[model samples]
Target: MSQILKLFNFIRIFWFLILPLVCFGQEKEKPRLELGGAFRVNYVYSSWKEEQKTKGGEFGYDMFRINAKASYKNIFLNAEYRLYSEAFGGGFLKQGWVGYKFNKKDELHAGLVYVPFGIKQYNSHNWFFNITYYVGLEDDHDMGLKYLHTGDKWDYAFAFLKNAEELNFGGGVENSSSRYSYDVVGRNKETNQFNGKVVRKLGQHIKHRIGFSGQYGSLYNIDTNKNGHHYALGLHYEMNWKNWNLKTEAITVSHAPENAPGESNKIIKMGAYGTPYEVASDFNMYTAAVSKKISVNWGPISQIEVYNDFGYMQKKEKEFTDSFQNVTGLLVTAGQVYTYIDYAAGYNHSWLGGNFVDDFSAGNPDAKWEARFNINIGYYF
Candidate 1:
């Protein structure tokens, strides 16, 4: 309770400080404010383990998100709050930030923002992105301060973050209840981090981005105190021609204990499955996707896109086998709404970048292939 109060107080103070600056402008121009949001729902069908199988279809709320933005001259504030049925009856602060633009080429921001690692955007066209996104290596948000620079041919960002996933004032055992839970994993604790990325545009049809990301923290073990570290190097490429788009990225992530015995090992929970397993210290991941947009003149159907996304993870260990996932889908968009239908098939477990699932039972290995069909519809207002 005390920690919650402290978090609330911090936000309140920040709000008060920014309110005066935004309200008392040098010019008479009124500040601009915009309110928008989105609602999403999904229907899913999956073949569970033979013993757990059932014939009934499943439907549920996907998400409800609200976005707010306010700007006055060069200072601006942006925030997003979301509610999810799978988030265990709690809301999430996806993004909340304040920024000031120094010029066209430079800007600074402070608050919770996406980490600068791997590909800057979604690595796949499907609703479930590449495996890297599941393990806090890609498309993950963190509380931090970031500086960005944009030039005629290049772009770069540098950031320093406290904690990996979200801001938690009440620090105790890390939580791992739902997919939307922001707590750091037990084996990979990201206390503080320095992340950087750079992109170079070579031509109108092709471009490249390379990034180096690293984090230093400690493992979340109540019995033993051990420091852990994470490092990754990634290369991303994109090509565009007419209505076709191609994107790919390859990243290598290494996680290890800073100081520990030679035989020290810990059982950690996998993010997607929430099952405990031992993992190797190193792994590699690759992802690729291609999409084509077809223009349409039909009523309420401006465009249709077809895409196939693939992801692979290779773990450098004898105890674990590699895993991969493939998603093929179509996206239809009209005005402020879009719908997606996709089929995903994977082996062993969800592609978790370097994170791998262990054998669940002697006869029933978790590495068995599984498939799921999903349809999602969303509207923006």
Candidate 2:
């Protein structure tokens, strides 16, 4: 009942705050609203599947999404909602936020927004992302306020995320984490996370972005009635020269959960998309990727991007096994159409055929290498 009340109150406050903006009470140069979305499908062939070699693979609908962006002068609203099949955890909002721009260089965002950590936009070229993503360290989103500043050579971002996305959207199993972006869920919930990141851009023709990110957050263990701590530090680098791009990053994360008596503290529970998993308490991760773009005049297609991404995760405990993932992929871009073809392989990875819950914690040391061939095609409007 209390949680329900809190949700109601949050909705009320949000509506009240946004009501004035909707009315456009003040002077405005006409509000602009833009609606766009994507329809995507996927094909996959996994090595671990018994019928993969014979049946070839499976092809099915991947997702359908709707994105909205409306701006009235300095204030704007951005949101994206996605729908997936029931087996894949059903529907959820990817991200939604309201923003006020103070100036060309400064802005503030409120509501459920992306966490400013590690690399901007994405840490990998392929769809599966990197190991840090599965662990909720990359491309994560939460509910709170964020401040950003973009200078000529230096860019800064600071955010205070109160919590992850609420579990009160769409229809799903009770307490099910069927949503976008990996987050701490179940009994141990994430709260009051503080993130700071800074980047320096160097050179004009051969562009470069060097950045560092750090975050500290709390985990509220419902059973313990106390707060645990989670901290991470990241070093990132990206360089673009002509049609070639390079990205590299290193991150170290530690999670100390205040668990119930006799419960294991070596691993903490984190989850997403209707599944809960255990992650190692302390680990170091690293990734490197390179891509090249080539122009083609084949009908509607205009460009092709080929890339390879590699990531590795090493646990602090000697008994725990490490994780590795590598993806070689190419992206084809046409008018309002995009296609991605990838060959991804992993050993002891959460999404690449390893045990879902224990892959990031005490993973099997003798895990065999598994490969997945995937193709994702989408149309945007």
Candidate 3:
């Protein structure tokens, strides 16, 4: 066989020259690849004095944020970038898939992960939006594939998401029949849904989390039904003692039932005159949050938080001209607290009308009261 393939490529080039420099001279020097990331630029002069102007009405420029993250050994990476000030923005991505210690316990991850689902709210984007920003149904970043198990007390996880999507609180992106606008959910590229989730833990504190995801696809310009689906449910809790800490969470969302019929009739005709009648989209969402911690001093100090969030939606029965009911409330925040160095300031408000309880209220009329004010900073590793 050609002399045994030339003696196996001459012993694989002498075993890559002394086995990688003798394993880097018996390894014991790591920490040169340290290049963390975080940058912020704020300077805003607010407006939209609550009265009426739904989603983030109008506020000038003065918000720039950039964050970078990395870790070695098992594996970790993070990235969040934002730039808003009349331009609007979106950013949030925390990843980890550390697996290899398949003996001591267990681990495995694939793309964009954060499994505990809730009740670990500390720096949830600068202390839960300083007391209001529709919590819960707003975590879980997509692109999934996870599995982790640890024993001593308990810890487990299971997730599988292909193309899940979510974003609300006046910032429309509805599902179950279509309600996308924010530039068509950011330039509609397409790939609707497919989701999954599962978490369980007991003793030594407390834990339990759940999740479900689904997305069929089809959405371009109303064609009497182009496919749809969406669903989720959750529950979580935590406890601690010494300094003191507590947490809570809940979530639910449903969608799937729309084939386009007797509603949504695209409009146009500037040359003549005839356009006004298109709003068929169903909705449903419920969220929650709670936090606590106090024991002040200086170095290892405390004096933490308490939070809230709620969302109820309805507009089925062939969704007659969308926008029926939406109630969002998140109030309760204290100033200045720390854990990993993060200065703070906050305010977020939301309230829109319409609802007759599964009867789908009378359509539209009463749209206003949207507020937001945030000053945040953080440094954690």
Q: Which model scores highest in lDDT?
A: 2
What is candidate 2's lDDT per residue for 1-381, written digit by digit as tens? Answer: 443354345446545665676677456466666778899999999998878768999999988777778787888988777777766666777789999999999999999898999898899888788777888877888999999999999999999998888675433222457778878776677889999999999999999999999999998787878899999999999999999999999999998889889988888877777677888889999999999999999999999999999999989999999999999999999999999999999999878888777998999989999999999999999
How many angstroms is residue 196 displaced in model 2 relative to the true structure, after the best TM-score fit? 0.2
lDDT of 1 by residue, 232-272 (tens): 77788777778887778888766655433444442234342
Native-referenced Cα lDDT, model 1:
0.66
Error of 2 at 209 (Å): 0.8
Report the CA-based lDDT of candidate 2 relative to the real structure.
0.86
lDDT of each: 0.66, 0.86, 0.34
For 282-363, candidate 3 gives per-residue lDDT tens digits of: 3343333343444445454334433333323333444333331111222222233222222222211221222212122234
Top TM-score prediction, candidate number: 2
Backbone collision tally, model 2? 0
- Return the candidate ranking by TM-score, descending: 2, 1, 3
Candidate with better lDDT, 1 vs 2: 2
Tally clashing residue pairs in candidate 1: 1
Ranking by lDDT: 2, 1, 3
